[model samples]
Target: MDLTVIWAAIIALGLFMYIALDGFDLGIGIIFPFFPDDSERDLMMHSVAPVWDGNETWLVLGGAALYGAFPAVYSIVLSSLYLPISFMLVCLIFRGVSFEVRGKANRTKNLWNLSFILGSAGATFFQGVVLGAYLQGIPVKNGVFFGDAFFWVTPFSFFTGMGLLITYSLLGASFLVIKTEGDLQRRMHGLIWPLTLVLIGFILVVTLWTPMTDPHAASRWFDSPARFLLYPVPILVIVVATFMFNAMRHQHDSMAFLLTIILVFLGYIGLLFSIWPYAIPGAITLWDAAAPRSSQVFLLVGAVVIIPIIIAYTTAGYWIFRGKAEASTHY
Candidate 1:
């Protein structure tokens, strides 16, 4: 019944939607260079073109919701993450422009190709850096940011950035397996096992590093007797990842894709469990970071109406375009 709880849920939902949805498209962009043929790359682009814009809407919604409903969180996080967030926005712009201009100018096609690839990687890396910075705990004094601008630039953050790139690449490869066929899908198949292995390594590193680096987060997982409530999460993640690996071997593209997504969702849920009740990890709880009650109620009313419509529209778009993408396919 608390407005802070309601808004926190809304913000979390929006961010999760953005990560899961836009993540694949960014992954596709990261893997664009693997295909030597421009035509194959076009097939990859076309596969995501129909839904990428809509997928990005969740990002906008998440940012807006945070700024509107939790101004304190917005101000502090934005102040701390200004440079990385700015860089991410610039990369996204280049990527979006590349998508639009690549077909129009054949001479500069290579330029656009590079733009898309770097843009995707840059955006994803910075996002991971932001995540790492938050996970490491942002410094706050009297409800304001007190950290240096370069607080996000560290070895662990860089490792997290690379981990995200690999993860996105894996997601992209899985998507290609689902949406492509013949030679392209075969190439994706070749990439899958290696990507999966690297991703497992990254996960292992994070799993080990997180608790060592942040004792508070460690306590959440280790000290709580009630944590048995989440006992099945790691088990489910392992099961899904195993199924996906097997599905990949069997060339069951759709099943592999679905399983991979489930794995990502389970990880997301695990993270939510670790960071619950806190909007800014150790620094600020959701209620402390929340806006006025009246503002939250007003926003909640609009969100209740708008969110379902967004979901329905996104579902319809995906349903209408459901099928494998071909070289000729373009949105």
Candidate 2:
């Protein structure tokens, strides 16, 4: 058994769970300005309040798993992209604090609101930037990061940051459609189609841009026989988008959110496929970066015991909090 492979799968699953869960709440924060009515904003925040913090659990899991399972990747990637990662953490901190303080402030409510918006957007943008920088390839030499401090800043990284903003905004809107009612719900419904179209545009741009600019990615998609298996990814994306559009048109509340998640899943699969076998894309393969076999075995034992508990609690929290978020409910 390749413990390295198992650990890689665990980290991937953990990161996706974080994206799928926390992305919506961050999206809610991003789109907060669109629904300027205080009551509507309250509803939006409340919609995710119960699960927002819990949703971040997966992020912590992913980070810890990476440090344990692939310490080299952790050190090199962090060193290469320290600025963006640090900014992301700071933004998340501010965002988390705003979540609590915004509800209590009266005279300063607007200030907190701004904080929340900036925090969420800043965190999300930096995350996307990190992803773009990673995809572009982190320079590594002799198991150390060999890149400049600002290696993460580029036109492509900024484009990806904007792309993620749109992606999360759509997730936030679709989620609100399921959680709010009447005019607010209708407004969210209105936002969904436009956001969906914009998301598709971004996906198309990335699909074309990645292959054209990154020969490794281009060859992975075009020159390999794996192309046959990978062809359905975009087709599935189109099909999912169509269903999401119809779901919104018909006011199938939950279906829109569910299908949006499927869209995210497909995109996630595409990204993993694009960088297959590389922990630091074009730099280090997973096997080369993995921790010692004994260390992985020990961590795997703990992960096996702990992951199920996290999943169980996460499931319970959502199930317990399920249903429309009442406007009167402030969290």
User: Which lDDT tens digits does candidate 1 get at residues 1-331?
Assistant: 7888878888889988888889899999998887869889889998888888899999999999999999999999999999999999999999999888887778889999999999999999999998888888899999999989998998888898898898888888888888898999998988887787787778768878887887777888888775787778878867877886788788887776677678777767767777776889888998888899999989889999999999999999899888899777656
Per-residue lDDT of candidate 2, residues 1-331 (tens digit): 9999999999999999998889999999999987789988888898999899999999999999999999999999889999999999999999999999999899999999999999999999999999999998888999899878998899888988998898888888888888888999998899988898898898889888888778889999999878788899889988998898788879998898898889888888888989988998888999999999999999999999999999999999899889999878865
List clashing residue pairs in candidate 1. none
lDDT of 1: 0.86
- The RMSD (Cα, Å) of candidate 2 is 0.9
> Which predicted model would earn the best TM-score?
2
- Superposing all C-alpha atoms, what RMSD in Å does each candidate have to the true structure? 1.3, 0.9
Whole-model lDDT values for every prediction: 0.86, 0.91
